[model samples]
Target: MLVALIALITTVLYFVGGALLMQRLKLTAAGEPPGSRGLPRLFTLWGAAIVLHAFVLYAFLFGENADSLGVFTVVSLTAWVIAAFLFAWSFRHPIHVLGIVLLPFAGVTVALDMALSGVGPATPMDPSLRAHTLLALIAFSLFTIAAIQAAVLAIQTHMLQNHRPGGLIRALPPLSLMDTLLFHIIGWGFIFLTAALATGLFVLEDIFAQHLLQKVVFALIAWVMFAVLLFGRFQFGWRGRKAAHWTLAGFVWLFIAYIGSRMILARLLGV
Candidate 1:
């Protein structure tokens, strides 16, 4: 019951933060400066939400009868990290508008985690395994953010190409700025992903017997995609739609590698 209450409060805070961000975006579209009044309040609210979210995670992970390392729990953790990173980044960048999507998503994840009360793995995670999992989740979260940024960049590109850059597009940072941010996100995600893969090698004893072959293959493919994209960006100056497409493609493969594989194992194979 206490957990439920905390989750509810966290959800409300997230939605409220999202609403505030949307309003800020609207004001920007209306010619108001992006750093106008009320930003500090929004930041305060978001910080409070993140704190409550951490409490919720603590309750689930450390409370009596706690053993929840399930999919939803992993996802909730990812959301929390993303929110925390974005909260810090927003102070220096025009990226708070991303909260319009991220905040609501975080709220929903919190609610789902509370309602579902996910179960933990059958066996306990060893230290190396835990380290690998943490790195992998961080990588996944960063890539998720990059994918969302790429989607927004696509919209900005479309609007610009059609000469209809008004509304939400007007509230976004300049195209070059957005492009640079997207690649930066991808670069960091790629680094974490590489580290995750390296750690995974130490954790896995037999990939084929453990049914991790597909996951590893898919992850490697994603790594290659991002590597190629980054190489192209520096070697050939790739940006705009091409970069967006590559970012999305890499995210898809990574999604399949982790989340999709888990779902299949749990639901279909009953593993």
Candidate 2:
């Protein structure tokens, strides 16, 4: 019941905040709006969901059941803080479009958190573990933003190659901006992924033969992909469609790494 209520509220926030966030990002005929209206109110719903989930965190932590699933809550909260900060920072620049992508992503995460935050040994945070976890998660999150940028870049590059523009393409940030953001995100994601893996190896009892091992495999594959793309970008000067394609590929590996783990853990094991 608690999970249902949280999901329902977050779902509403997604719709309401997502729709209004779009309007708040309304571009003018001249250019992007004012360049500084600040974050849209709809985004507040996302924060509210994050804050609300803290109750769940506390409950599971202190509740008689002491569900191990509290780890999901921690993960969800970690993502929320990172996304919120990223969105807030990006908004100060020309990355308002990111809000549209991130808010919906976060909404889905909230729902997932609710579903999963019901099992596990309830590993409470220790200083070193928390530090490693936060760094890894923030790095992983950058890949998410990179994924969104990749999608936007692909669409823009397509329109450019075909010599068509306007509509959603117009709504996109400049292609160069998108590309720059992609590389930037990939760079951060790679670095963070490295840290996350390192931390996981230290924190876990067994690194291999578990779901975490699978996640590490996929993540390493993603890191390699990102590394190759980065090399290509700098050395071979891969740009336009090739860059977009590589970005998408790398982000796909990243998606499988974490989301796949969540799916197996939550759906199959009921954790």
Candidate 3:
């Protein structure tokens, strides 16, 4: 009952934050300068939501009978990390607009974890494996943010090209700034992904025996895709649509490598 209450409160806070952000964006679109009080309130609400969400995670992950890392739990953790990063980034960068999508998603994740009761297999992990998992989750969360940013960039580019650069485009940072932010996020994500893969190697005894071959292959493919994209950006000056497409494509493979493989193994193959 206590866990449920915490989850409920966290969910409400998340939705409230998202709604407030959306309204702020709308106000910006309508040429209204943001109220000085609004930003502080939004941050407070989001920070409170993140704290309560952490409590919910603790209850689910460390409470009695917590033997496995459930799918919903993993997703909730990812959402939590993403929200935290966004909150920190907002202090220096105008990326709080992302909360218009992410905060509500975090709310839904918390609710789902509560509703499903963390349903998953009982796979235990040692410290090394736990570290690997943590790195992977962080990398995935960063990629998730980059993917959203890329989508927004794609839309922003399209609107500008079509001479309809009003509304969301106005709400967003400038095109060059958005592009720079996306690559910055991708660069950090790529570094974490590299570390995750490296740590994964130490934790796995046999890839084939452990049924992690598919996961590894796809992850490496994603790594290569991002590597090429980064090289192209620095070496050949790739940006705009090309950069957005590559970001999305790389995230797809990374998604398949992590979430897709887990779902298949847990649900389809019962492995």
Candidate 4:
């Protein structure tokens, strides 16, 4: 009961934060700087909500008799990590443009986690497996941020290219900064993903034999796509729309590799 209450409160805060961001963006015209006055209070609310959410999640995931890690738990944890990172990074970087979309999505995931609970089998808490899982979650969180950055970059590019920069573009970081952030995010995500894959292949060798071959294959593909993007960024000076498109494309493969494959194996195939 307490857990549900916390989740509900967190969900409300996330939605409210997202709505506030959207309104703030809407209020800023194409040529005007984004409003910053309301951000401190908003960040405080998010910090409080995330702290509660993290506490609830830690209790649920590591409680007595919590031997199995379920799909819903994984999804919830992934979103939680992303939200936590976003909140922390907001202090150093002006990446709040992502909150307009990410916060509401986080709210939805929290609600779903509370409502549906877990539908799939839970994996036992093996130490090596836990390490692998942590790496995977961290990698996914980084990639998720990169994906959001890519999306915003795409929008910013289009608005500038078409000279239709009256709404969102005004509120976004400059294009060069957005592009730089995207690559840096992708670079870090790639490193984490590489570690995740290494751990999966070496520590969790049985996963491939146990119906996760598709996930591994797609993950490799996503890794390769990111590699190419990074190489192009450094070697060929890729930027603007091209970089955005490739970043999104790499994210697509990753989405398929992780979440899509999980949905198939657990929900559809019932394996």
Candidate 5:
């Protein structure tokens, strides 16, 4: 009951904040500086809700002899971390545009986790594996954010290409700046994912088990895709639509490798 309440409150705050931010954006043209009169207070409310949401997760998802991860747990935790990252990044960057989409998604996922009582089954673990798991979750969260950013960049690019640069387009950072931020995020997420994969291969006892092998294969493929995209960016100056496409593709494969199977098994098969 408490968890449900927390989730509900968090979802409401996210929706309210996102809606207000969108309304503010609608008030200005494409290139004009955004108004920021109430954003600080809005952020304060968001931060409080996020902190509470994290606490709820700690209470329910972690405790003595509790170390299980489920499909919903993974998604909810990743969204929580992404929200934290966005909250921090907002101080240094104009990424509130992302919050407009990210917050509502986070809210819905959190609420979904509560609704399904999806506190995934507990698993006994080796201490060493914990670090790898943390790295994997962080990598996933970062890429998730990158994917959303890439989506926004793609939309902005398309609008500009066809000369529809009003509304949200004007609210976005310059196209080159958006591209720069996207690659920077991808670079960091790639490094973290590489580390996670390396640790998994070296540390896990049986990464090639039948149920797990497909995940590893997909992860390796996603890693290679990101590597190729990064290499191309530096070597051939890949940018604009091509970069956005690669970013989304890399994220899709990563999602498949990490969350897709669990979702199928848990939500679909009731396993």
Candidate 6:
């Protein structure tokens, strides 16, 4: 019953989010205000969907008893809050393009939260450990979403650079601004990834034991890739195609660290 309920809400949010995004894209392409007639209503509806989705997961954690779900619940809540604030800020910064693109992705996450449910205390582990884990995961989540946005931005940037026309390219922000936003997001992500690794190490002793190693290794690899990317960007003036490729590579490692660790922890190691 709980699983189905959460899934239903998850699907609703995904569908609504897609509609809102498509509407926004259409408005932008038309050279009209992104906030057009009925658009505010759609945004408001999305807000409600977000709140509803959060509550459903919270219930899944508090009402039922699943540690893994609770871990996911806390992370999802954090993502919700961040996405909300970022979505609002996108108005001035225009970084919201990434946010809208990423919103529907959350639905996949929420569904996974339901599918991966197992028997345990909804609230798991010591408070300190929980805090570290959730913080790390949430940080990775934002950057992961941001990475996807950067990919789109890069494609848009490329098309404009080459004087290509049509498709979604016409609606995106200019190349310079996209590059600026890309760096901004990656810088923050690197910091968070570092802190996540540090805190994760502190939270768990013996890095090789249990699920720690996989998360740690992939996380470290992600951090290294970004570090190299940033270094190349600053030192060698690596921009455009190189930047996009490097960004995608870094995110690949991050995905493994995020979803991969969860699976190994939940299924393989039984952590």
All candidates: TM-score? 0.94, 0.77, 0.96, 0.95, 0.92, 0.82
Q: How many clashing residue pairs, candidate 4?
A: 0
Candidate 1 on 1-271: residue-level lDDT in tens? 8878989999999999999988888887787756658888899999999999999988876776354377677778889988988888788888788889999999999998888765433324667887898899889989988988898998899999999877688777899999999998899999999999999889999988787889999999999999999999999999999999999999999999978887677677765
lDDT computed for candidate 1: 0.87
Backbone atom clashes (below 3 Å) for every candidate? 0, 5, 0, 0, 1, 1
Q: Mind giving the per-residue lDDT tens digits that candidate 4 earns over 115-156?
A: 866677566778888898898889989999998888888888
Q: What is the lDDT of residue 222 in candidate 6?
A: 84
Model 5, residue 98: displacement in angstroms? 0.6
RMSD of 3: 1.4
**Clashing residue pairs for model 5:** 30-170
Off by over 4 Å in 3: 35-37
Best by lDDT: 3
Q: Candidate 2 regions off by >4 Å?
A: 1-11, 24-75, 119-128, 209-211, 269-271
Instruction: List candidate 4 segments past 4 Å from native.
Output: 30-34
lDDT of 6 by residue, 2-76 (tens): 657856776577667766777777776777755446656666766776776767666765674534444455455
Question: What RMSD does each model have against the real structure?
Answer: 1.8, 4.0, 1.4, 1.5, 2.2, 3.4
Whole-model lDDT values for every prediction: 0.87, 0.68, 0.91, 0.84, 0.81, 0.68
Model 1 ranges with Cα > 4 A deviation: 30-34, 65-68, 119-123
* Lowest lDDT 10-residue stretch of candidate 6: 116-125
Superposed by TM-score, candidate 2 places the C-alpha of residue 200 at a distance from the truth, in angstroms, of: 2.9
Q: After superposition, how far is residue 162 of candidate 1 from its true place, in Å?
A: 1.6
Query: 4 or 6, which is superior by TM-score?
Result: 4
